[model samples]
Target: MPHKYHESQVRRTDAVEPSEEEKQTQEKPAQKEQSEEEKQMREKRRERTERGREVGAEEADAGEKT
Candidate 1:
């Protein structure tokens, strides 16, 4: 008896080649230097995000305790 499914019956898609422009963009772009003020602002934003997460967790725990 023949099997109900066969690998040969399955269709496969071929990989498309990237255009010249796409290939160029695929390469890593130059990184811009960040100024001191930019760096400080990024750090402050990160700290605030983390603090918010901590407060949310504490509130969840308080709800579970009560």
Candidate 2:
């Protein structure tokens, strides 16, 4: 016996619909604003670190001369 592969058998006749929860999830906005705030906070932290390093180097130089 030969196997039959038909287009009608593979195709779906009914339209697939999203459930209520799925619809709500699709509608909800992700935390893009929160992510931007976090990025800004990280940049500020890096700037502070660089400044502290420069100050530490200056202090060490002053101490060496004393």
Candidate 3:
């Protein structure tokens, strides 16, 4: 018997994925607090919710009056 290495076995490389340095770089950029745009969106959502509640309240009042 003799040791035989095939072309496929000899031509193999490291797994195609992120390296440790790449992983480290990605990990360094931590998610910060809510951005200004996010804050504005949240404020707009709150305003819309408040408006919906007020509209519902007014509709109830109108129903009682009718």
Best by TM-score: 2
**lDDT of every predicted structure (CA atoms):** 0.62, 0.69, 0.67
Error of 1 at 45 (Å): 0.2
Off by over 4 Å in 3: 1-34, 57-66
Q: What's the TM for model 3?
A: 0.35
1-66 per-residue lDDT for model 1 (tens digits): 988656554332212566677776666343223356678899987876676687886775575579
Q: On a 0 to 1 TM-score scale, where does candidate 2 land against the true structure?
A: 0.44
In terms of lDDT, model 2 sits at: 0.69
Quick one: ranking by TM-score, best first?
A: 2, 3, 1
What ranking of all candidate models by lDDT puts the best one first?
2, 3, 1
* Model 1 spans > 4 angstroms off: 1-34, 57-66
State which candidate, 1 or 2, has the greater lDDT. Answer: 2
Better of 1 and 3 by lDDT: 3
- Per-residue CA lDDT of model 3 for 1-66, tens digit only, reads 855876676556343567798886777645333366678899987876676687886775575579
Q: Per-prediction TM-score, please?
A: 0.34, 0.44, 0.35
The RMSD of every model to the true structure, in order and in angstroms, is 14.2, 8.7, 9.5
Worst 10 residues of 3 by lDDT: 28-37
TM-score of decoy 1: 0.34
